[model samples]
Target chain A: MHEMSLCENILQTLQQQANAQQYSKVKTIWLEIGELAGVEADALRFSFDSVMQDSIADQARLEIIDIAGQAYCSHCAKNVPIQQRYDACPECGHFPLQIVAGDQMRIKQLEVE
Target chain B: MCGICGCGEGHTHSHEEDHSHDSLDHDHHNPIDGHQHAAQHTHAQGLSPARMVQIEQDILAKNNAYADENRRYLSQRGILALNLVSSPGSGKTSLLTETIKRLKEELSIAVIEGDQQTTRDAERIRATGVPALQINTGKGCHLDAHRVGHAFEHLALSDHSLLFIENVGNLVCPSAFDLGEAHKVVILSVTEGEDKPIKYPDMFHAADLMILNKTDLLPYLDFNSAECIAYAKRVNPKIKVLSLSAKTGEGMDNWLKWLKAELELQRIDYA
Candidate 1:
């Protein structure tokens, strides 16, 4: 829902990193967004275009890497993949599992020159 | 106009006066035009193509850094800061005003009210005779850590005091932004659906305590208390639940007790 602000943050990061990284324009940006991050990939992509337009990453490509939500269920005794935080364990039907992974929004890499 | 794309928006650079990306064939050398924008893209030295740069940085790292600063500031001073989050019309301000009225004399209380475009919440808070700062987020949906830090600078909060950060009335967006609060207290009113916990699981999961407000209206509505608590547990097993009505003050005492306990704990920790 706040994808626009998120895109602006991405642009700011790109610009700040440009000085040290020795790059003028960003060619592609790869983001790892988890299902539990409360971010929609399509919404982020849509916001990326406007936020990046006319900037150093103008016309840049945004590649989102989807990270599946994983949580450890004591009943299952293992990590299980679920879509939402409130989802019940697929194997044991127990919910509110201990979250082990996902819920991350990070800039993994950038193709710059 | 951008010489590369002809987009008449950005500031025109001297080197890019007539430079076109299509005509670039190692034009680093002067081509009668001394204004060369070759520095726009730094030379790759040995690499011939675009190189991959590993960042592995959190997108919210800047905000998180600011939040960490706020956390350090509050924790060092033994200030108990609570971030109050809920949907619009969920009685967050009302509950805060009510809580302030009860605890203002006993506790050194301050408030930071956040809204998209109003000082209304802050006004309500100040009427309780406690120092309150209003942060109008403008187009922003949530109160960011940086903004909160600025507001904190202006508010004269005493040591061992309680700072209540009434965040923008948004459940989904505010769930992600941490405002350096000791805990996130989500106020869920019975007027809203009991299925809210499941629908907005991120907020329920992130929150440490869930306050079921407007219990006074529970008798007239079909809101099921048990089902709401169950759903909240389904999302967050460790989430503490408290049911109360800010209007009638039916269970406000419990909420007050919880706040006092947290404040005392912080004082102990600070000592």
Candidate 2:
């Protein structure tokens, strides 16, 4: 799964941040995973646990905040919550709506000590 | 006012006190050993709570950087790169074989076949007398930008060349990463329902062209060509849709024409 690779990147970023700040332990990690980011939250948590073993974040708590997918409906002239990219607006049946938000995947904050 | 630390006139002293209280609270709650607690306190002061917000860095930044580099590399070599995405057993190898057969005489073609394991697809492409390299992702669900970069090293791309990267049989994860291709062509066989574009819209949204493969088998299946096209068009209005049967060679002329047009477009850009 791509989650494992993403976990590896997370670990690398964590290691770099910890080294830069001279922190020996990371207590909690707040991650923002968007609904439309195509990444599974459970799978990412599972992989994070497996990949962070013996690393600085071994006992770290992962707090994942799921962002709802939002889209700008061209025909409706309003923002709509989109479950899938091609989903038509509930208010107006419009194809090819532009995505406004909810494709984000980022580490929001780290509680390190 | 220091932007990095967020320490203004009235906030500096209180911020230090609040920082100390936070570390003290952490020590009271977790109760780590003396040495570790001391080490943590030193670093804890530097942790501004403002770092929590406005860190608008994209998570896919690393992959996008690699993809940008790949685009530059491909541009320098004057190669028109296409990333082919589809479900497993969707006649990708067959399509590649037929495409290579048609274009190898007039165009320089190279292939990078991605699979979980095996060189079978590469072997099939090589049979057409074109150079093909196999990238076994080794249990990976999809190919990333870095892997494609590595594959480019072994490919001998010349001026006015075509390079096809057959991504691992996946419709989801592959859409999230850009491989620096001029076009992303997604194939859906007739056997796979017409509603696939609606079900997996990310792939359809990312795709520049959609090919309804295995059209020869349509009589045996319950697929309605019009419905499939409608679904794809609904998802991505700009997607060019083509129906073809790699087995019976039906509707291949359209595919060939699209390829030739892409090559000509690349030539025009180079000119």
In order, the candidates keep a fraction of the true contacts of 0.69, 0.37
If scored against the real structure, what TM-score would every candidate get?
Answer: 0.87, 0.82
lDDT of 1 by residue, B1-271 (tens): 1121122244232342264211111112111222213225445567665889999999987668778878888888999999999999999999999999999889999998888876778888888899888777667788877667656655867999999998889988998887788999999999999999999999999999999999999889999999999999998889999999999999998999999999998877632
Tens-digit per-residue lDDT, B1-271, candidate 2: 1222122234322432454311101111111112332233442465653222223346666667668877877877678899999999898999999988888889999998888877788888888999887777776777767667756655647777999999989888788778888889999999999999988887998899999999888879888889888888877888999999988999999999998888777765443
What count of clashes does model 1 give? 0
User: Every model's DockQ, to 2 decimals?
Assistant: 0.48, 0.25
lDDT of 2 by residue, A1-113 (tens): 78887776677666546546656667788888888887888899889898777777787888999899888887888999888777778778776677788878898877765
* CA error at residue B107 for candidate 1, angstroms: 1.1
RMSD, candidate 1, Å: 10.9
- Candidate 2 off by > 4 Å: A16-25, B1-55, B268-271
The numbered model that scores best in TM-score is 1
Model 1 chain B poorest ten-residue lDDT run = B22-31
